[model samples]
Target: MTKREIDEVSGVETTGHEWDGIKELNNPMPRWWLWTFYATIVWAAGYTIAYPAWPMISSATSGVLGFSSRGDLKAEMTAAETAKQDYAQTIAAKSADEILADDQLREFATAAGAAAFKVNCIQCHGSGAEGSAGFPNLNDDDWLWGGSADAIYHTIAHGIRFEGDPDTRYSEMPAFGDMLSKDEIRQVSSYVASLTGNSTDEQAAAAGKQVFADNCASCHGDDGTGDREFGAPNLADAIWLYGSSEAEIARQVRTPRHGMMPAWSARLGDTTVKELAVYVHSLGGGE
Candidate 1:
C-alpha cells in the first residue's frame, strides 16, 4: 500500500486518488451531514418495515401499517358522495322550475350540471357549450325547438330526433332533392339567405320569393321567421345550425341535415337531468 500524501498548500492529508497531478483532500464529512446520511438510511429501513417498499416476483411487500392509497381514495370518494346525498334528494324532489325558485338548490344544480356537462356533453356540445357544426349552440338565444326551462328539460329527458326514445322531439324536413329542380332549389336558397343578410344574387332572391311562398312558407312561415311548434329553424336569425351561406341554404333546401341528441335523462337519471336543465337555463338564453 502507498502512504498517504499531505496537500502542500492546505497541509491536509491527500486521498490516494489523483488525476492530472491534482490530489484529492481526504477531509472528514461534517457532523450534521454525516448524521443526516445515517438518518436517511435508518428512515429507509423503517419505511420498508412500516409501509410497502420491497417488490417481489408477483407482488410488492405489504408493510406492517397495512395502509393503501386506493383505500384512502375510496374512503374520500364515499365521504363526498354521502355529503351530496341531501342535495341530490332535494333536486330529485323538485322540478327544474321549482329548483330555480330555491336559490340554494338552484346553485347546487348548476354546479352539478356543469360537472355532468364536462363529462358527457363536452364531446359534442364542446367544453364551453359553444357547439360544433351539427350541434346546436347552447349559449345563444336562437333555439330550434323552445328555450324555456320546461322545454329544455323535456328535450333533455326525451332528446331531439332520438329513435331510442319514442317521445323524442321529432321533426322531418322532407328532402326536396327529388321533388324540386336545381334552379328552384337555388332560387329558394337565395331567398332564404336574403332573410338575414344581403343575398349574393339579388335577382335570384327576387324570383325565389314566389317559390318560397309556395313550397317553404307552411313550415318556415311566410316571412321565414320559423315556427318552433314545427321545430323549424328561424331563417331570419344569423344563427344557423348548418351554415349561413347561400350554397349551404341551397344544400339544406335540397337534402336537409337533421341533428340528433341523446335522451340524457335515461342515462344520467332524472335528478341529474333537472340539474342539467337548470344549469343550461342559467347559461344565458333560457326563457
Candidate 2:
C-alpha cells in the first residue's frame, strides 16, 4: 500500500496522486459548503416528491400537489377569454363604421383583427399583406370594390364573387376573345396598357381606343378609369391584380380570371368580420 504524502512546505496532506513532481492537496470542503450541499440534496428529494418527477409507461407520475402546467394554462386562457367577453359582445352589437368611429374600440378591434389575420389571411395575403400574382395588395390605394372602411367591411363580410353568399360582390368581364377578333383583343390590350403608359405599340393603342369606347367605356369610363360601383378596376393605374405585361393583359382580355373570396361573416361571424374590415382599412389604403 502506498502511504499518503505530506508537503513539507505548507504541512498540508497530499492525496498521494503525483505526476511530474506535482502533488494534489487533500483538502476537505468547508463546513458551510458541506451543509449547503446536504441541504440542496434534501431540497431536491422533497421537490421530486412534491412535483411531477417520475416517468411511467403512458403518463408521468402526478405529484402530491396535483399541479400541472397545462391545467394552469387552460385556467389562464379561460380567464383571458372571460375578460374579453364584454369587448366581443360590444363589437357584435355595433356596426363596423361605428366601431371604427370609436378610438378605444377601434384600437381593440385592430389588435384582435391583426391576430386573426395572421392566422387566417396570412396564407393568401402574405405576412405583410403584400399580395402575390393574383391577390390584390391591401396596402395600396387601388381597390376593386372600394377602399372606404364601410366598403371594405362589406367586401370582407360578404366576399367577392363568392357563389355561396347570395349578396357577394359580383362582376364578370366579358371574354373579348369570344366577342372580338384576336387582332382586336391585342389592340385593346395595348390600349389598356397605354392607359398607364405601358404600351409599346402606338398604332394598336389608337385602334383599340375606339374598341374600348364602344364596348368598355360604360363600365371602365371614357378615360379608362374604373367605376367602383361595378367593381371594375382602373386600367390607368400602375397596380395590376393579375399582371401588367402586354401578354398578360392580352391573356386577361382573351379569358379573364375572376378571383373569389370566401364570405368571412358565415365562418367568422359579423363581429370578427367588422374587426377585419377595421384592421384592413387601417392598413394605409382606406379612403
Highest TM-score among the candidates is held by which one?
2
Candidate 2: 10-residue stretch with minimal lDDT: 1-10
lDDT of 1 by residue, 212-231 (tens): 99999999899999999999
Q: What is the lDDT of candidate 1?
A: 0.90
- Put down candidate 2 lDDT per residue, 1-287, tens digits, no spaces: 77767899888999888999899888999999999999999999998889888999998988899989899999999999986888889988988888888898999999998988998898889988988988888999999888888899899989989989999999999888899998898898899999999999999999999989998999999998899889999989899988998899999989999988899988998888888988998999888
Residue ranges of candidate 1 with Cα displaced over 4 Å: 1-5, 15-22, 38-71, 100-115, 118-123, 126-128, 175-186, 282-287
Error of 1 at 22 (Å): 4.5
Task: Mark the 10 consecutive residues where model 1 has the least summed lDDT.
Answer: 142-151
Over all chains combined, what TM-score does candidate 2 have? 0.82
Error of 1 at 202 (Å): 3.2
Runs in model 2 lying further than 4 Å from the true structure: 1-5, 15-23, 38-75
Supply candidate 1's per-residue lDDT for 157.
94
